[model samples]
Target chain A: MMEEGVKKFLYVNRKAPYGTIYALEALEVVLIGAAFDQDVSLAFLDDGVFQLTRDQNTDGVGVKNFSPTFRALGDYDVNKLYVERESLEERGLTADDLQEIVYEDEDDDWAEKPSIRIISRAEMADLMHDQDVILSF
Target chain B: MSTLHTVNKSPFATQSLLSCINHVKDGDAILLIEDGVYGAAAGTGVSDAVAGKAGSVKFYVLGPDLEARGIPATRLLEGVEVVDYAGFVGLAVEHDRAQAWL
Candidate 1:
């Protein structure tokens, strides 16, 4: 549970979603944190950027793929999704390269989509200092 | 010139401990926190590896974590300081940088 009046919760995601539980766990944490009405932001770096990549397929692995769950975040009131610019460039992906975000029509996801900023790792690290609770998953 | 390296997981858990120690400089302080605290009570294997890693780094552990985990202060390796959270924060603010090995 989050503390009262804790505005800033920085969630750092540093692993590939498919390979491990790190990304799924991180996404779950952020949604839960937002449900508690805390100010939350997510930073995707390292292999974590892959979690938002285009067309994630887990069917061949004989398990549920969680890529689509990210589309449900807006419904859960999670709006602050950030991606490191350098990470995308390194992975040869851009905003257009991402999968079609299937969010609810006529929802806050539109207004929130414009606020999804791209930043550098250094910028992300500096932002960590101001967060009330910093969790790296 | 004191640095505390905090190692929480069992030695075999991950490569975080070795990776963290590899990057630490001499005279740095290392504090064992969370799962890293378990490393201190394990055995000489950790000490030998840490000594090799500590070019000049010192060792410290959070007293709260140790006690909560049922690991006694006396059971810790030589030259390891048993301190609290205030001490841990002091180290982070005192030192030039802090890197978590988890």
Candidate 2:
């Protein structure tokens, strides 16, 4: 259970994965923050939306291909992942092109439901304002 | 409330430090970590930019980062504070938010 004084933490990912370490590092922070039971939400905008694209094959590049770790986020109780609609449209991607993430809600008798929420740019801006801490990468 | 801004890239490597300086508001605090500690060095070209904000904005450099990079505390620009990880967390609590310039 979350503590009474939990602060809203919004991790803004605006960069692409692989070329830079921002994407992976941001994920590490998210996982750590969840362990502290902080109210955490991740926002994917601009090139960051690329981090979630489906069918990422790193065999050619010889990288770890850590994208699959996102699937495990639900178990950490860090399920609020928001992807910006404008970012996806600009990148020529649709929601279906990304990996499907789901979490089991214990409060609802452990029912499974989709975890990724596709939000508009305006909604993202509003969400940004609502955060007590904004970690941008 | 002020915001605690953290920059972890070198100014020579990228414009992350410069961009961060540009976005700082009055009463805000800037903490340099990792390669960003390079900007606090006395002779770096970006020192003038940091020096310019002396009165309005507080400046800080992570001590462990500076030591790891072999940058002595005496070599930092005037008015820059050296902080450890504990101080970093304290600054976060002191400020309204923390913005990491990646």
Candidate 3:
């Protein structure tokens, strides 16, 4: 299951949802890029973790809540979502507060598994360093 | 006259929270809204600064914003109160004036 010329693409999201168009626009770009079949990963740090928080109702603001779209990412084979532990701690958040995103492992008898991975800030830096392309928002 | 100061930016990202803290007078209340709730967490680089002002100024964070950001009330610094939307309105009404730190 090896492919030649496959580049690692990492999308770094650091903005809060609904406050600005950055989070939403970054999400759209990730979805569109999924069609290219690149080795994609998403890194959420700073205020970006707020984008994946549960129970986001935008009815009062009249903006469509696009958080549900993240669940669909697994369908596009973009399931690697790495959240920085230090960022969450600084914001007083835990992994349990985030919306559950699961993907089926084709290699492991189609077993369902979580898509979100909580990683340290240093580990996040290592991840960024290993990427072939990094797109920051 | 007492004042209610509202800060909407994150402490790590901008100077809005710190500036608001520096300028708050005794008996004034500082309300952390939106991304500003990050400043309410315990053991941060700015925790001592916040605690240093605790004796003079009251600190509060919007409950909904904290919940939206997944920040539990238990994770907040000692003495930082969590206020609901109604409480937010109450603070605005209770204070003689309202100041928004942009």
Candidate 4:
């Protein structure tokens, strides 16, 4: 259950994963913040949208493929994953190119629902403005 | 409700500190961590820029990061406050939000 006075927390990701530690470190903060039962939402823009792309193989780079970890965020009740529409288009990707992360809606007899929400840049900006705490990575 | 800006890179190495200082508003607090602690030292090229903002913006450095980098508290700039991890958490809670300049 969400506690009283749960603030809207938004994590803005603008960098590509693997090239820097920002994406991974930002994921760590999201997972930790889940325990507080805050209104958590993640926004992927710029190269950050690459983090959700499918078939990410890190074997060549000799690093662990942490992309799969994003799939598990739904289990922690963190399901508001927003991907900017323009970001995906600029990178030559579509919703079909990304992983399908879903969550079981307990309020509706455990029906599966999509967690990733593809929104426009203006909508993403509005979401950012609505947040009480914005964490950028 | 001031924003807490965290910089994790050295001024000599990256422009993260400079960019953070440029964007921070009045009453915003800046915390230097990791290699960023180097910016808190006195008499550096970046010191003058930091000093100019001392009146409006507050400056802080991570104590553990400074120690790990062999920077003593005495070497820090006059307005720079050294904070431990606990103090780091306090600043996050004290401010309205935190922006990490990675």
DockQ of structure 3 = 0.02
DockQ of each: 0.09, 0.25, 0.02, 0.23
Residue-level lDDT of model 2, residues A1-137, one tens digit each, is: 65888989889887888998999999998888788888989988778899999999899997879899999999999899999998899789999999999999989999998889999877775676567889898
Native-to-model Cα distance after best TM-score fit, residue A105 in candidate 4, in Å:
0.8
How many steric overlaps are in each model, in order?
21, 0, 0, 0
Q: Provide TM-scores for the models.
A: 0.58, 0.62, 0.59, 0.61
Q: Given candidate 1, what's the lDDT at residue B47?
A: 67
Q: Each model's C-alpha lDDT?
A: 0.68, 0.87, 0.86, 0.87
Models ranked on lDDT: 4, 2, 3, 1
Q: Please identify which of the two predictions, 2 or 3, would achieve the higher lDDT against the true structure.
A: 2
Candidate 1 segments exceeding 4 Å error: A1-4, A100-112, B1-101
Model 3 per-residue lDDT tens digits across residues B1-102: 676878888899886677567545678899999999999999898899898998889999999999999988888999999999999999989986665654
What's the C-alpha lDDT at position A112 in model 4?
91
Every candidate's chain B TM-score: 0.81, 0.97, 0.97, 0.97
lDDT of 2 by residue, B1-102 (tens): 678889999999876777567656778899999999999988778989989987899999999999998988889899999999999999989988778878
Clash-forming residue pairs, model 3:
none
Distance from true position, residue A90, model 3, in Å?
0.6
The DockQ of predicted model 2 stands at 0.25
